[model samples]
Target: MTTSTTDSSTPAPGAAASTDERIAVVNPATGLQIGSAPVFDAAAVAELAARGRAAQPGWEAMGFDGRALVLRRMQQWMSDHADELLEILQAETGRVFEDSVLELAYPLTALGHWARNAEKYLRPQKAAASSPFVLSRRLRSYYRPYGLVGIIAPWNFPITIGFGDSIPALAAGNAVILKPSEITPLSIEVIRRGLEECGMPEGVFQIATGAGATGAAVVDVVDMVMFTGSTATGRKVGAQAAQRLIPASLELGGKDPMIVLADANLERAANLAVFGATVNSGQVCLSTERFYVEEAVYDEFVSRVVAKVSALRQGVPVAPGSVDVGAIITADQLEVIDAQVRDAVAKGARVLVGGQPVRGVTGRFYEPTVLVDVDHTMACMTDETFGPLLPIMKVADADEAVRLANDTRYGLAATIVTRDRARGAELAGRIDAGTVSVNDMLTHCFALGLPMGGVKTSGIGTRHGAAGIRKFCATKAVLVAPSFPNADIHFYPANEKVSPLLLAAVTGLYGTASRVARATPRALATARRLRRELGR
Candidate 1:
């Protein structure tokens, strides 16, 4: 990882340019260098942010409809280039070709949704005045863009998180400077070109590739920051934004739980458990990490899960039909997974299926693992094992399941598997997570109208839905008063005549007595006298 500050000779990004320092983009599955990008330092990050700031005004001039048009064109471009994009996704992130489909589909859906609904969601909204005195004035709140927005996306689902976030920010009329994870920078470059091909203004969308330092530099310059990663990094980003008094939306880590009740469909629950825990090699933040099955059905459910786990195929993940699990992103991640599993075994947890890293495989690959008898004391149960490690524990009842599920600091998402859909939904409500699914695994995150985010350490703000676009904007209160010949009663210096009338008015409106009771003889007389004196 090489780093260089921006200078006069710094060529435009995405073009082949050799500098003193560059970051190599290696294929995680092959351990081969496929590409390289200039490692931008603080000065380069600042320069890109400055460019975005300068371009924001013209982009904002496009307004909601005009911006929506650009986003739709981007969606079309994505469709046109789908094959090439999917190939690049597999090359970099090592996700199975089927899972990589979402990298394009999700952003396209979000683009279409935001383009069609932005005006409705962001249009000035009328708000009622709290007091009678202001009833005659019209009150409305307008949502305006935050000028230049800085986005730091993760490698797990680069296109979706990167451009999914940018679509709404752009639709809301703000210029963006995105820094994709170094591991998956190429995918985002393709997205940038799509935006530019669709006639987005120069500098309106930018990508800076590097490591953590690059992201921190972006935060230092931009008006607002949107980050998706781990909780520890999210805290640092939040603190940096706080120091600058600029708001940052963080989508962080999760130890998502799946509650399997006695009434659950045994086969269906087992299938869901395997898919939920093993998808993307368990790299997803909302992936199910812990399973709490009712004691009565524990043995059967565990056996079914172990069977599914054993049947899963681990490979390079390039082929659509042959692979179910892909390579881990890095060797460091594999070591972390191994350490957690070792800790769990030492602490009395038993591996029911695959437990160790895959040997004689190309690149960083790990077996889809299933562990039984895992307890809270084990590291794999308590900490975020961001690999394909499924830990199952038995609970006496639903109450115990809920208690154990809520024990973790992360609350990004959870799932409830039961025969009674109503009961599943009710139990979902009881879980302390941002998104909850009933009789499902990850379906709750795909809808465009629903908000997605986490509570506690999971994240600070929401993404998607109307709230998604609004997150990139700030609300401004607008008040318009009707023209009148008479001045406002409370505007002038205190006068003997108006003082008593104003006192009586306050007493009549806000006093403890009923309106009729407050309208006593003295109050009525005072009102009449004021009306006459004021010529109302």
Candidate 2:
């Protein structure tokens, strides 16, 4: 909504803000104006979309190997200029060095992974015919890129979510238009420069930097949209994409739960709880927002978590090792965090560590907090507290834990900690979340081979694995009939003789008891063989 910038201000060189209207970029860590990005209205987004469309054919013509060459070089560019990138990221997002380091690391792996794996993942497949009628025909499917894609990235983890997602889209042979969050648009300018230095074709990848309006414009213009943000915003984007008949892949909010069993390693679980919930100032969608601990070890787990949280240093992140927790990205978000904590306290939740914003700080920072005696009625337990807050609840058993974990509308991810990993995994299956980690937390996001996304209100579609790259593509099925008769029996005229033959064939293949009787023994034998092999 704040769309105007000072006339005296100069735009960042090579920034995509071609228009006079600009969105001022502020350093959440310092509470200062760092830079500004152009406010691209609907017309500007359309123009950029057209440029991307023009460049797409050339990029697509380059083929997978050619794109990989550019992407690999970009990876090298990131390594060479890591400090500059990280500084920009830290300034804009207010993430601590360690958290920012992880943010940068993701894109490095993503660039290489998508570059190397895109072709293999999207390669044409020879699909087997499902019916006897099509047995003579060769059925194959191939993926083709959408000409242009728009990525609406969130303010948190701008580099990882902003550019990381674009890697697969670009590798899939689509030109990408990235609309980074207005809160942290500066870092993306640096990334855009790196891509150019890496010899990526001009206009093949462009940044449309502005606020929500710009993001909406991008959704309106591009062939497909991939959005990562809050669930409420995701729903709007999804609706817009639906209206245009474009596919939308949204990775939205999460109130991810962590369940610690009675037999769990309290030390490891506590360590992860502190790290998972406090990292990125607990702004991650995958952050463990609430905990459902088995009653037997609840006291010990809470004590350990409180100790670790109390030790965290919250302040402005000026440099590496300066603080364990950095400032919240905006005052609005800080207020949200404060309100949630206060609401929890009002509802009889006791804050064991921190319950208020850090005092005497120029920038917004909330102390790493641990809450116990929390329940489903509390905001901290129900709503997404995307801040440095962890609320732990004692559940009678794993069944109750699973029930409480699945009770929320969010189903992004959940974690289970137990010495018996088999039982942990069994409990994980019962938790209704897209990703369930046994004896671990947040590490599943790094397993690029596995698809990650959410269900229910959290998100639709996924990122990573085959789906990540393929979602940028449109699949085509090709069927070839080889050595076909001049006039097939099933072809034109309603032949009475052909009808009976077809009926007999269908009945014999599917409906007949004789067919089932003949196949039963073999099926049983195969099942027995599988069981024996699995036992071995």
Candidate 3:
């Protein structure tokens, strides 16, 4: 694929030359030329910002209903055009068509749900007034939009992560400026313009096509930012957002773990383990980066997993009803995966199964590789390879599995394949992650009810559940006085007695609730005796 040339030379559509048209766009799956996504220069960026600023007012005025209607219909259109979306996604990112839909479809589906329920969710709720004397008063809390939001999205699962990250901000009434990766820009436009056609006002959903520089500009200017990418870039975005104190929700990186318990259904776990580690060519934030298997079942599990990995269909992911294990998004990413695999081998790690790419001239395809004897010290074990590379290690039991799982600086998501639901939940609780799946890998994301985010280096804040849907708006507290004399209790000299009395009353209740519940036997007996004596 060759990049289509477009004029991004003029800034503001009227200024002198700004960005010289740059770079060709190559289709990842087939290496064919697709149309170009313009790389905006400073002038074009100014225009985009200006348009976004202009659109914000009309969009905000749409209130909740109008915006919801548009999003609701947009969700329908997305469902209807699911095939087209899958095709575009596969072409642009080398993700298998089925996995592509799995990633994109659900997040887009969330649009309708968010639109329908966001009004209630985003609206302010009543908070305690605290002072009982002013019980007649009313207080409520609500959120406000963060104006413009900057989104820097990655190429892997481009549509899913991209839309999932931005939709909440839009629902919250913030104008969004999206920066899709240089590698997968076309699909983003498909997304950007889709919202446009859904009748979302211009500027409200402004799309600026560019690479890192354009992305940096958004960080320099917008109200808040949501980013999904490598840990390195996430750190940079975090730093930039912090420098401006512009509050960012970062889905940085993950070395997510998947555990197979001794009690786990070895068949199911093996099947999922192979599919989970290699889905999207393992270029997934939540993919199983590390596998911990109980010693009793370790050998059998490893054997079955290797056999399944060897069975994955590695090829061009676009043919009809193709058996698909997706390709890595780029040659550079291919190199990264290759180096990690080669290094691991050199450093005494054994490749239990496939290591090199299969016979193909298509996209960046790598055979599903399984590695054993991997320790935490190796970069392959610690960092995200974002390819179909699974490193397995043996553990004595589930306890050790849990320890090894939590042993990373990153904890975006984890999956455990065990038949014991209660044990899975218990283990999940002990695990430090935003989302955990029992008996499957990456399936939890399909659950709209589940919130998606991470702990440690995974990310800050959340998305996908109620917390995510509500993060788009500004929460504000409103208080109204009872218009009575006691409402002015804080006026000080107006009521010295009342202030202390009220303070004591509130403090005493709080103290009694928290401190007196487990009072010493002596104290309880004394109180009982005193109560009896007083009654007499």
Candidate 4:
């Protein structure tokens, strides 16, 4: 994998606006500019929104069943075009085809789940009975769309993260204006082209192409912004959304942990740890950054992880039949990762395998590295390296493991490898991360029914299954009175002391069996009479 070698020879008909559009689409697998386009100006952004607004009323009026059919069709269409989508994904991110296949599957599964279940989860429902005798007053809650949704997605797993939000937002009856990462716009283009081919309304899923400025414009105009990227940038998006009184679901960053119990199968734990940390060259939000192992098992885990890391292969992204780790997304990201690892080493961390750069690899490929004796103060441990770097620390027991795991500011995900089921549950409870896996790795996020969002700096709001679809809609409470007015309950102008009296009577009735048993019929009759008079 090399730095971007984008295909910028000629514009693809209508890929951009003017002839001088300056958007460069780079292939992270081999630092090449494989494509180029125009940076969308504010006018383009407004145009996208205008289209969404036009499509809104009709699309939303179709009801849940109508939407579900379209979504299911899209799912089948995605499955049919899986090979084509995988090609684009591989070209953009340089991930192995198998990994790309897995990434693509996540959004497809989520879309299918939401389409089939959106009505049940997002449709209006009557709220619980608020007050007895207040039953005549009808009250309900409904989820309403936020008009158009702006999703500014990152490059890593571009399809899933970008379209994942888009599926629900569209299913819940909101139009979507998606600004996919310029680093990997091919997958975004595929989605856009597919939507267009499906006869979906033009503005229902607008595809905007550009860099950070394009993403910022998305945040500027939309009713809601769903951003997935760095913590620092997430804060900026969050603050802007706040100022505009719009909600932003920001998945900032994560320094995820992997806790290995002493009795764990060290071999399985090591294999997964290496895969989790080094996969996709480790540009993952939930990449295992810190590993807290029992003192008895630390050495074994470290040795195995180091050996696995050393054996991984790196090559051009489009290479077939070989597991090739791709390059870091950009040169700037490469610099950031380098600094983190260097600082970590400076701060007492020891590199175990493939620590330095390889001479033959052309792109931003850092060797899959394992570090031991890493402290919390080390940049590799504290900051999001987002590279093929893992730091293993020794802990005396589960207490210290939990303590160290929760020490970070971000709480996205963590894993506990243990043979004992009861002990896994106990340790899972003690861990502060949002998603925890017991005796396994690489799944938690793909569970369509699970609500996956982070606490602390990781994110606000959720996206995946039930929560995702419901999140796209707004809750509106509908209350209606009986068609004919009843005069018996109309004591509007009175002292309203009846409220307290009724409460006291109900409280007395619920006080206890001993008190009720000791009370006379006369006392109970008086309470019953008050309740009847009050329309309870």
Best by lDDT: 2
Please give the lDDT score at residue 115 for candidate 2.
Answer: 87
Instruction: Report the C-alpha lDDT of model 4 over 307-398, residue by residue, as the tens digit.
Output: 77777877666556576566777777777777887888888888877676545655567777778889888888788888888888999998
| Candidate 4: stretches off by over 4 Å | 1-19, 488-490, 495-536
Please write out the lDDT profile of model 3 over residues 1-536, one tens digit for every residue. 12333322112233223365754666766777665656776666666776777778788788889888888878977887777676666677766667776877666777877787777777778876444443556788878787888888898866777777777788878888777787877666666667878888766776666788888887887888888888788889999999998788888888888889999899999888877788778887778888999999999999898888877787776464585686667898888888888888888899878888756475567878899998887778887888889899999989898998999888888998888999899999999888888887776666666688889988887776677766655567787875557535456566755555444444444456555446554545544443443342
Clash pairs for candidate 2: none
Compose the digit string of candidate 2's lDDT tens values, residues 312-427. 88887766798899879978899999999889889898888988988886778888888888888888888998998999999999999999999999999999999998998888
Considering lDDT, where higher is better, how would the candidates rank from best to worst?
Answer: 2, 1, 4, 3
Better of 3 and 4 by lDDT: 4
> For each candidate, what is the lDDT?
0.84, 0.85, 0.76, 0.77
lDDT (C-alpha) at residue 86 in model 4: 82
TM-score on alpha carbons, each prediction: 0.93, 0.92, 0.88, 0.90
Model 2 TM-score?
Answer: 0.92
Off-target runs (Cα >4 Å) in candidate 1 are: 1-19, 514-536
Task: Give all candidate RMSDs, comma-separated.
Answer: 4.5, 5.6, 5.4, 3.8
| Cα shift from native, residue 24, model 2 (Å) | 1.7
* Candidate 2 error regions (>4 Å): 1-18, 513-536
